[model samples]
Target: MGIAVTAPIILGLTLEHLEVGLALCFGAFWCSPSNVSGSLNHKMKGILLSALLIMVVSFFGGYLHYKTWLILPVLGFLTFGIAFISVYGFRASLISFSGLLALVLSFAHTSQELEIYQYALLIGVGGLWYLLLVVIWHYINPKAQTEEILAETFILTAKFLETRGQLVGQQTNREALQTKLLNLQSELVEHHATLRDILIQSRKSSGISYYKGKRLLVFVQLVEMLETAIANPVNYEKMDVLFKQHPGYINSFQDFIFEMAQQLRFIAEFGNDIKKLPKSKELSICFEKIKEEVGLLKTSEGKADYEDYLMLQNLLEYQEKQFNKIKKIKWLLGNPDMDAKDFIDRNESKRFIVSQDYNPKVLLRNLSFRSNIFKHSLRLAVTVMIGYVVGNFFAFQNPYWILLTIIVIMRPSYGLTKTRSKDRIIGTLIGGAIASGMVLLIQNPYIYGGLGVVSLIIAFSMVQRNYKASAAFITLSVVFIYAIIQPDITAVIQFRIIDTILGAALSFMSMLWLWPAWGFLEIGKNIETSVVANKDFLGKISHFYQHKGKVPTSYKLSRKTAFLETSNLNAAFQRMTQEPKSKQKHLDKIYELVELNHTFLSSLASLSSYIQFHPTTEASERFKMAITKIDDNLSQVITSLNGGKSQNMASTILQGDVFFKEQLAHEKLFLAQEDKHLERHDQEAHLVWEQLRWLYTISGSMLKLTSSIDFD
Candidate 1:
């Protein structure tokens, strides 16, 4: 509290009121931050860094007799350059913007130097008060943050599961869920980075059991599958049986997730109630069931280890209890969704055909952090503005004045840009108006004291509440200072309004004109690629279904092809949603493909997994060669499907058509000519021929669909 109280006074003496406005500008740049929640380590570093920067400016500005206002601009540019790498992109933004604001508002004023004792008391007191509030709030009730994050993760997982359930060949909707799932990687990244912030109790966070990690990994794998299906439509026949069985075996998995969600809400309702803890072994039971099912079905090459399995199971149990405790109330029934088969069922759907010989591993794409060209351009433009302006202003050197600067820059997506811009303008305008009015009233000391107290209350309340509200109070504080001290209201209001409006206008225009956001065309192109790939995947599947004897790998290749296509579609659709509202309707239409793609792929994955697991053990070579041929054809089809614009894909296709195989290769098949004993040939050959004809018909229809969509 003492530190909080003294902070402003020291600031006024050392920076805002510096003899040269230039030195004050540097100090002001350092002073204006809303520094509450940063790591104690980071905050200490910030303090040291700011002091060092100020000292540099003071030496030159004081010796050169440069005004604080003018010299401050130089410090702003210099600080941004020096701190950009160290501070990180967003923090650097704050420092850079603050410096520019000081220069813009430069007025002739000199600050008196503060004694060391006074300086220590002011900053130290103010900071301590804020720190106490933060520490208490965090420690007294800490579970809320963790529960909220868990809820978010669960919901996201549920959405992906929904998408996976619909992938190619088994359902009405293909790739319908792809778009939504693509955003998972970004969210995952954010969650990973701020795990500590999301969960207050470090000990409890570490308690997460092994099963929980595996479950998360499973979810990640599911998303990977969803993305692939979107990129290329998969052939269901080639899919492993597990994919098909999953939809049924794990029916309404999301409902179970939803049950877990109930705890998330309770934190608010009961304030960390103890009774709410999934007081029973329900989560443990759930994990046990999951493990049992995995074992029965032979998941992940029929060899999921007990160690990892049990660990994951324990983690789930732990989360269940923690999740319940967060809400504060107890639920007697727990989850009604828990059922008999959820624990016991092994999918009766078609099984896989594991070969005696080894099979190759499947590799799904991973999340990447590639640099975006457009973002780079935007960053450059913002930096240029910070540099050019600071090259100009300086008056009596006062660094603390930097704290008063108010300018904003932002992107429309995060809600930061609009909120900051509005507050910056409103606070400046209103503050100036009040300042103009205050100078006349400053003659009375009681009135001045009362006003200061009111300002303090507003600052505390606003600081505890929202950023914009806090900024508003800060603006008022600045006005109060000038008005009570100078006793001139009208001129202050006029100039303050002018400066704020200018800053806001400049920011808006710059963001609007430079490297503007892209529109729907790019999104459309991306969707087209996915759709086409899916179509091609369907064609290969058609081929596999028709030709069963020779090429065994046809079905497997088809599923993989589908997975790749699905990936591309999901990514494109995800990108589209972040666009402005005007582009949303079209993007939504395209995003629907994500769900469709997911359904298709899961079915295919199930089939592929099943086949890989349970290969009909007869002659190995004959079947293997046939499978290889089919796989080759599928690879070519996938390549053709993904050919974005103009691709000459003739050479990439199967060398000789199946229809022409007997004719071109001179293979002998027992055939009865139109006059051959009037259909008296052997029944087996006749049956085989009829079956073959039906397969070709189905295959032809699929090919037509696959080749239909042209990306361009």
Candidate 2:
């Protein structure tokens, strides 16, 4: 961005075409946000699309700026059209943002038709220049972004595991820990999505090279580690009950989990330099300590408490599996030439890369009051037009500044828009005050110019990471730039604050009144999707158990979908809480549903994880019945949520109870033996049966919960 902005300035100054240089800078600055991390093809496509849209919007905006009577309709049409493109997905949304920004900024400069064409062309050229620089940088360091995202994923995963460890300790607040886990899960889902796009798209475009393949393998390990962690779904209440009789066991497990987290953090810290990757910690000692505790419990309690002993053993085994996954990741990192085929098939790997639906029909389909994006687009257009009218009516110094604030602050959701509006206002006020003081104390244009450049760099870099800080730097950059060009710096600062507040007010009001799509109204769909994903995940686990072998790509994909949907549901619930209390319908019920859905996913993970690691007996009749009942319950829940009548399935419920009794009787026979030890297969089968029964019960609860919710 610095290069893209500065190079044009230098050329313009050298040629005494300062306006032309600034126009080019505007072009680059508007398009740079879309040049984010992705595969080369995606990066190129996003930037090129953004450049084209910006040029077109700029041309039209400039042509209509002085046509007073036509401003409202043209502005409304362009804003809606550009904003509506977000239906294509995240990358498209960024491009849409760039276009909308260009439309607003275009009104700031007046030009004849010829001058407009020249400015628009120069802006397009500037976008192309930025694109060129990005490509060069990509080639120079293709792996850097992927590595950085992967490193972040490792860190987030560590935090997630650490939180899970906290959940194990007796004195910790489980509610707080659960909330922390949810937040971490949400962050991991986002990072994982980005990493997936980078690694998977790169493989599709450039084919898998050694480094890409290795990174992909490491990513798979990280994902498996997450699933494995999720699979260690310790019933905290039960754990507490057991630990009351056997203290220090919980501490040992907690320490072991923390150790795993520490190992992951180490990997993240030194991931870029494989040679510096630290040696694997001796987790075996921790395992031995825990094992000794479990052995003592078994000896002291005898066969009467063998089930508890098995539970402890299962927990221990889960940790060991987690430890092995970390070890495997470390080995993969150290061994660069490791075969990618061992991880995922080249031909089948494309299934994991989620592609956006770029079909034009998607846009037309979303052009309804029912569509959230459509409502948001319409809201944005009206708000921007209102901002324009209010600015002109008030005769602000730069009416377009109001438009700029509107464009930047407004978002598709109320929570996001409100948060951005507040941050923009607060940051602008502080930034305006600081700039006011700086201009009063300093009189050098050179200082202003340098500071403007520095501020622009920081603002650009921090936009995604810290919006408040970015807004501050953006204010400073704009003020300093105008300070060099305009004499009345005080008015610029004053109007900046006023315009921002006005635009924010317009945005907030528009979101409130213009077909507002409250999160509660839409959260049901999220809940439905999450439940469906969990159902599919359960089916996958059932199939995996029936056919014991390597975890298929389909199973992994289902797991990913389940996790992602649950994360989305959690995010929606969070957004709903942030919305107006009056709009947050069924808040308590929704929270309960969200928690149940999350726990169900964890239960699925536990069942799947156990089957994946341990050797289990044949998929028994009782197990099949349990899985069927759970599947029926989930399907019924989905149906009920979709406004269809849910079948009671009383017969299936009765059969499941009967099967459970038979399985329990069979299990007791093994416990009655003097040896108090069952075959490994018998033990695994019993655990798997228990997991299925547990899932069936949860699914029944979810079904009842769904039926009780007043979705309307």
Candidate 3:
């Protein structure tokens, strides 16, 4: 907003050139969403690179303007190439977007420009102005980004804690609570990515203060502690069974969680300026109450099952340690001089890394019409050309509107395209109505121009956050600007609305009927990938156990990949649900698959958490065999799903061996002995049993999924 208001004044740019500059600003802003607190140097470099690309695209677009026949083919290929390359990553995608927009804008106004290079130069200058404003804003409010990060981290942690509180009750919907927890974990993973960016920026840039770096380090440590707590959250269902006879203890535990959540919210509110840590004795009291309840059970005539007692004891001890960690974190937050440097260990984040073969030969070898991105690019090219030809045939006042609408509204997936189509139409109608009213009543050019700038500022600001609102404001800004230059807006608004609708309908139709990428169609492949990743993760887990629970980087990476792949599978299914009925396939089975995948991961996570705390060298031979069998079954299932030559093991894997159940029962009997004490490996063995049970269920689910599909 500040950039839009002051860039022209600062750079002495004329309003005509400012429009080009504003376009560059808008492109840069859209490209780098959620990066307000990122390093000024990176931000500036990105915009400058985007600006240069735009200049080159614009220059070539202008040079090719006179060749009327080449325009469609050239622009089509340009759009196709740019959109296809977006398969790489966000930064690369944004750079591609800038180039595409440059081509579009240059193609539109090429005939009017006497010197094409000057117009391209003006666009570059405009990008530079926006870059300057962003840099200045970062320097002026250096702590704002760090503060935002802390606030988000704490808020998410609070929400997760709240979910944990809810899950403590037997009456709670475990599936729903589990879903919410998984979502929160995904959000935390996203936060970790953002924090890594901030840390990297701090390391490279002197603009960040030492105090700020130290503070971020402390928050990073706090986040890691929170992660450990959230990730290893007790299987509430198990806790419910343990506490069913003593609801009082559960209530007290809930109270502690509630207080902890409140404490986190307060920290979020204070951020770096916390005067003193919010005091809370509720957790301590709750801990004592739980201990008392457990003691009473031990003294009762109807003695509690020793295995249950051991489980409860382990949980309570974990909670006590977690409580102390939270209090210590609060104390550190309150003391600004605490040595967080020693505790800050930044893990390299791979959350947003999309692996793509950039080598031309490799890309060419892999390239085919079957690629979704390639097909999407082709669809876009055809749609844009159709829009252009249709508009020109109809003698529309602005043929470019039709092309622009197609460029902005089309997506690879039917669901996204359908959504954007609605937003574009609704936003255009509203903006047109408002602009028409203002144009009919007001004749002041200055007022109209100011309103235009204000609308432009708002549009750019909200573009990343809310596309519908941004579209409306962008429409209003464009209309007002047109009104200032060309006063007759009745025809303009009518043309704008009609052109937008036409283009949107075309784009939507294209996405729906032209090489549409239905998630459900590819869900089998997604499931296969997920199963393979989880298999690798299970292998790593097995290796960790074999090596006395040492978590190497490779194990962590495999775990991360498994979780991320599951999340992706979940997302694909979710997107499929929102799509048209025609796009939704194998609905019930897909839902079950997604649920099973989620449960599988959560179950493994529970086991992993316990194994980390208590290294177990005594995992029974049967337990190891169970995991190996599950891994083999997973590979077989993936092969079946992919239509490879594999025999159906549905009946084979569905039937669990008595050995696993016997081993688990034996462990329980040993733990239940009156004089037997709680051993570390005993708890580990129990968790292994629990995880095996989940894997058995997952195997059954895989059988059901494969049965439902007609792979033959």
Best by lDDT: 2
Candidate 2 per-residue lDDT, tens place, 1-712, comes to: 8888988988989998877887888888889879876788999999999899898888887777555556888899999999999999889999999998899888787643248788889889878888898999889987789978888899999999888887774754778778788888898888888888888788778776778888888888888887777767778788778788777687888888888888888898887678887676467788788888887766655654676787788788788788888888889888866777567677777887787888889988998888999998989898888888888888889999999999898888899999999999998988898989999998999999899999999998898888888999999999998999899999899999999888888989888998899998899899999999999988898899888888888998999899999999999888898899999988888899899898889888887767776677787666777788788888888898888877755665666667767777877786566355533635675667677767777777777788888786
Give stretches of model 1 more than 4 Å off: 1-109, 114-189, 196-260, 268-273, 276-407, 410-471, 490-494, 514-712
lDDT tens per residue, model 1, 232-298: 3334443324335454333333333344444333322432344454443543455455546545443
What's the CA RMSD of model 2 in angstroms? Answer: 2.3
Backbone clash total for model 2 is 0
User: Once superposed on the true structure, which residue ranges of model 3 sit more than 4 Å away at CA?
Assistant: 1-6, 9-45, 64-70, 107-114, 163-183, 201-255, 281-329, 344-358, 439-442, 618-620, 648-656, 672-681, 710-712
What's the lDDT for residue 392 in model 2? Answer: 83
Candidate 2 off by > 4 Å: 111-114, 282-285, 302-308, 336-343, 547-551, 649-674, 679-681
Better of 1 and 2 by lDDT: 2
Give, for candidate 1, the lowest lDDT window spanning 10 residues. 360-369
Sort by TM-score, best first. Answer: 2, 3, 1
lDDT of 2: 0.84
TM-score, every prediction = 0.45, 0.95, 0.86
**Candidate 1's error at 80, in angstroms?**
6.0
